[model samples]
Target: MTRRNRRMARLALPRLAFLVVPAFLAGCASPPVRFYTLGAPAIATGAVPTGIVTPATPVVEVARVTLPDYLDGQDIVVRAGNQIERSATGRWASRLSLGATDLITAQLARGRTDLFVTDQPQSLPATWRLAVNISRLDVTRDGTASLEADWSIIPHDANLPILHSRAAFTQAGAAATDGDTARLTQAVLEQLAERIVAGWPR
Candidate 1:
């Protein structure tokens, strides 16, 4: 009510406003929540075929593998109803084909057979050629991954596939992550390789 009291009240009001405003701003500026991703594990290499015969004259050659061009052009299907992540380079590197190449390399390194050449020249001496048909390769949110392949091994002189077979394998993973697709891809390749080696003609 007095003049001095009124002056003191007015000064105190400004200080209180300053303190309250800072506190309100600090509360509003809380830190943001963070999210993280997890990657899938490597595919397991199954049992190696038994009773494999070392060739008397091991053929040392690599066959040229042909893949459907569409597989490289199309988006990799990671999961149903989920859009595939485009590479920063705007192209997928043909992961399935890469996997097949890796499989051939691995088999060559096994050292069971002596054949070891990279080129596919018609005149080059090769025991057999590898051809593959990719049926299904997909990752799913249901913690399941699958790969299916139909393959054949034909002798150089023969038009018909000397040996033909199909191999399919699936495994359940916790979720998708880096290299999960690669792992599944490897699984399919390994199975195909095993089948081919097991069914090699005597």
Candidate 2:
């Protein structure tokens, strides 16, 4: 109420306001929430043809194939070299390592003859080894999907390869979405499996 008291109150008000304003501003500011997409659905194929004779006595154990450094994760880089933003459903982000491994496993399983295939690494008493290499896997903006795979089967002792093959397959879908991509990939793998199985030695 007094003049001096009023002057002191006026000076203190600004300091209090400064502190309160910062606290309010800090509360208002928050880190943005990051979003990711759910992976696409897996494609299915018909049962593998009968009489393939996939190692009746387990003569060879198929080893897990090594994937290239690129295409190792769901961190996808678009055609323009920019990372694609993941959708709310978690599609179109990228393929996981396990996904690639599974794809190869399934392909081999369908084509396997006189060989046992597995994803786990193990030292097995087997007569042969199978190796796989994935060269390119991509889904273009135009909805065309492409896949290239190289594979070989060799005797455990000899360096010479018993069976060597390379396959490239493509499928065009209505869209470049994850669902379409998975479908196309599955189709290509199925075809490749058939080819490999047809050529496999009995």
Candidate 3:
């Protein structure tokens, strides 16, 4: 090549690299994913109160909750009127289908002192089975959270009548962050648990 052309080529090479390096680095960098759960806030071990379980107390098995196809996954969603948006960085630690059951089991155990509630498989047969199904969960970025669900208290004996009930709950709060949104979800589920425990069958 000519002397003048060679000098221009050398000058352009370094400039091109300097311009491209930052863009390459930026493209490689990605936001970290954050995980959230429906479980209640942690409490100090000694601070948690326990219930007395006698042999006579009936065992209630809490079956996993049935959720809608949209909500059964891990994505944390926000509802804006007719549209739904998924969070870019936030995700459910456990799938909602299972998480909702865990939350209900914990809440049921915490709400009552006379009943033995468990979500795990037990050697002792459960006298009653608690089933929960979710119809909808409406959550907004900064406004409110609401959910609709129906539950049944089924007896081990077919002769006994099974009680069926439905409930709708709403919680008003500021859920600007994903963590805040998870807390709001927990609050509404706790309200649903209240209704279920209140309607406990004889």
- Highest TM-score scorer: 3
Q: Alpha-carbon error at 187 in model 3, in Å? A: 1.4
Q: State the weakest 10-residue window (summed lDDT) of model 3.
A: 40-49
Give a tens-digit lDDT track for model 1, residues 39-91. Answer: 11232222123334343443434444446554434244455565444322122
Each model's lDDT: 0.52, 0.56, 0.83
Q: Per-residue lDDT for 1-202 in model 2, tens only?
A: 9999999999999999999999999998865433233321242321232344443445444455455565555544223234433333323233544555555555655556335555555566556565667677665666666778888867766754588899888877744554555566556655655666576666
Each candidate's TM vs. the true structure? Answer: 0.54, 0.58, 0.81
Give the distance in Å from residue 198's predicted Cα in candidate 1 to where it truly belongs.
Answer: 2.1
- TM-score of structure candidate 3: 0.81
TM-score winner between candidates 1 and 2: 2
Local error of candidate 1 at residue 73 (angstroms): 5.9
The alpha-carbon deviation from the true structure for residue 201 of candidate 2, after best TM-score superposition, in angstroms, is 1.5
Ranking by lDDT: 3, 2, 1
Kindly indicate the candidate among 1 and 3 with the higher lDDT: 3
Q: In model 1, how large is the Cα lDDT of residue 161?
A: 54
Model 3, span 1-202: residue lDDT tens: 9999999999999999999999999989878889998875342211213655677878888888898899889999898878889999899998988777777777777666567787777787788999999898878876699999999999888999999999899999987888888888888988988889788875
Clashing pairs in 1: 39-177, 59-115, 60-115, 60-116, 60-117, 61-115, 61-116, 61-117, 62-117
